[model samples]
Target: MDYRKIREAIIEETSRTHVHLVEVLGDTITTRLLKDFPEVSQVKLRISKPAAFSDCDAVGIEFLVHR
Candidate 1:
């Protein structure tokens, strides 16, 4: 596990993390994920709507929260 490879693996794992903005369930999901993955002591949640627009193909918000 080289440093860069380990970092890339972490990045890849985190890349799949998401929160859907419309359902108001992002918080719930975040809480659950935080509980399930203790490695995630804190996380910067990014919610986006890439399909909601054409120009930017996205809009989002970030929340820096911790358990």
Candidate 2:
């Protein structure tokens, strides 16, 4: 599949799951992507949202997955 298709699939699946946690979302994506692309042995995902405080731009979480 192409990059566009892979991206669309990820977005669709993530929305369907209705999961809010960054860690869970990263893990879920890693698992699903790895199934289709065995050459990918690692996935590094980062999620950021508007900062709760006025000090910075955003707050985020990063998850690294290895198979």
Which candidate has the top score in lDDT? 2
Task: Encode model 1's per-residue lDDT on 4-66: one tens digit a residue.
Answer: 644454455445565344334446545655665666677566766676877787776666678
Per-model CA lDDT versus the true structure: 0.58, 0.76
Candidate 1, residue 38: the lDDT equals 68
* Candidate 2 residue spans exceeding 4 A from truth: 52-55
- Estimate candidate 2's alpha-carbon lDDT, on a 0 to 1 scale: 0.76
Which residue pairs come into collision in candidate 1? none
lDDT value, residue 17 of candidate 2: 61
Cα-based TM-score, every candidate? 0.49, 0.70
Model 1: lowest-lDDT 10 consecutive positions:
19-28
